[model samples]
Target: MTERQALVVRGGWEGHHPVEATDEFVPHLKEHGYTIRIEDSPAVYADGAYMETVDLIVQCVTMSTIERDELAGLIAAVENGTGLAGWHGGIADSYRSSSDYLHLIGGQFACHPGKAPAERKGEQADNFVPYRVEMLPAAAEHPITQGIGDFDLVTEQYWVLADDYVDVLATTTQAVREWDPWHRPVTSPAIWTRQWGRGRVFVCTPGHDMDVVRDRNVTTIIERGMLWASR
Candidate 1:
């Protein structure tokens, strides 16, 4: 079989465990005949030639910054037919300062509200609320989400700000809990895909950590998404 090239660009906040998260899929990428090049920073994105040659990019950087040229190069690669796939804050919450990056991904991490004040213990884990990922009707036929039923997860349920460019596959709703100020439940796209130029972009909002990424449902969706998004 012919070999394909994949790039794993990871690094940012340690809380998301970028290394471990991406590691979970590296072996899978290899099994599928992909030669992988792993980078710890976005600097590699500045190399337009290398970026154009990459068939896929699995990014896991969260709450980080990207330089102007780096962001431009990354965008150009995707627009030129390089697939981009990532989950949780790694892709959705990454590059908060770069609006162009947000436009490329088609979604932004707004917040993940925690349990009620009375239930909190002054820890970040408070945001790990029980939630369900509801697959949309159309997703029943989408390759990335097909055969994946609605599932429950007790993790960071991201409230995303998404645009019309995305094709949402699955969604999660945040209820109006006692502590939450919203009057009604808010629904956010938990899994989505975007087509930019000749490239494909896939984002899954449930991968807050390794365990979450390892969830059977999440794993299947991510694996299929990576392949489906590839050029």
Candidate 2:
């Protein structure tokens, strides 16, 4: 039997609490029989030899900078066959200043246009809001969403600008109201999958906080996604 290994990198903007979020996910990987190694920074990416052994990479780092060499190794690992999976701003909102990283990931966080007025704080968008996720036709048969159904969530409904290659799994259509400035009903991809070289990438834009991930349906789908993406 072959030993399974996974690398979990966590850091970046403090607002998302990367440490807490990664803490919540590590056990899930462990439960699947993976020997997980956790890193608080991307420096681990500098070791090309070490990265080659990883079967999956679960990155929770939000908006943070990565040194050129470090970024190169991480990209190479994934391109060579290491699976990559993450959710929310951690992956989509990561490395805001790096276009190369964004290109590899296939999507960028555009905006959360439907944030509730009461939840909004200063310039930063609100974290909690009631919403419903609609499953996409293409995702109906996908392993990650097989048993999952449309469900409601109390978190930000990320409106992403995805690349043409992404296989959208689910979407959330924000309701429109007269008082809302953005009247047009907005549809955001809630979950998606993409391929990078010989590797697989899976992303879910719903895990804003631990509570959001605690949703039974959300947990099930994300777990299934991790398994589907793993090599």
Candidate 3:
């Protein structure tokens, strides 16, 4: 049998440490006997034909622009049957100019008012508040989050615009801080999965830095998500 193939596309804003994030996970995929091809640019999306042959795509891109042709190619490839996975802005907040891309990913990054590094000077980071991730009761038994319970961490909590149809696996409650208003605590999706045609889409909102991405639970969840989504 042919070894499972995976494509890792990395680039865009350096603030999120896209390269580091990709580095941390590629080894796990290799351990599972995956043939990995790493792309350092978003231009790889333009190769519709090349994309179709792969089984999974791990994208790590921040805010960037994709040409019309490249965007179309990517769409066709994913819809045809390509598992897509990524954490934080690398996959979620990337290509803001293309609403179609957001629609494909099932969510878009709006704001991360948590603790951001000085590198992301453009982003407004107040206190990188400590918070807990609560697994949704309905999805607690799912493979990706099964046997996983609540955990606390201090990191940038992402406020994303997510689709209602997504199967949300975990969530975090917004804190009522002195700096911000919205006194009513809001529950936001921390990790979720969706189906696009024959493809599976997985999104995790936790990785604001390398440390968070390296967290054992975070890595386990993303690794499982990638394996579960592969064709």
Which candidate ranks first by TM-score, i.e. highest?
1
Compare candidates 2 and 3 on lDDT and give the better one: 2
By lDDT, the best candidate is: 1
Tell me the tens digit of each residue's lDDT in model 2 across 49-106: 9999999998989888988998898889888999999888889999888888888888
lDDT for 152 in candidate 1 is: 98
Q: Which lDDT values do the candidates have, in the order given?
A: 0.94, 0.84, 0.83
> lDDT tens digits, residues 1-231, model 3?
468989998889998898888988888899888999998886887887788888999999898788888888777877889888888898889999998898898878777565434434544345366788888896578888887788887788877788797889988877665656577777778899989888888888888887788888887888888887887
Alpha-carbon TM-score of each model against the true structure:
0.98, 0.91, 0.91
TM-score of 3: 0.91
How far off is residue 197 in model 1, in Å? 0.4
Question: lDDT per residue, candidate 1, 117-198, as tens digits?
Answer: 8888988788899999999998999999988899999999999999988999999998897766789999999999999999
Question: Candidate 2 at 148: error in angstroms?
Answer: 0.6
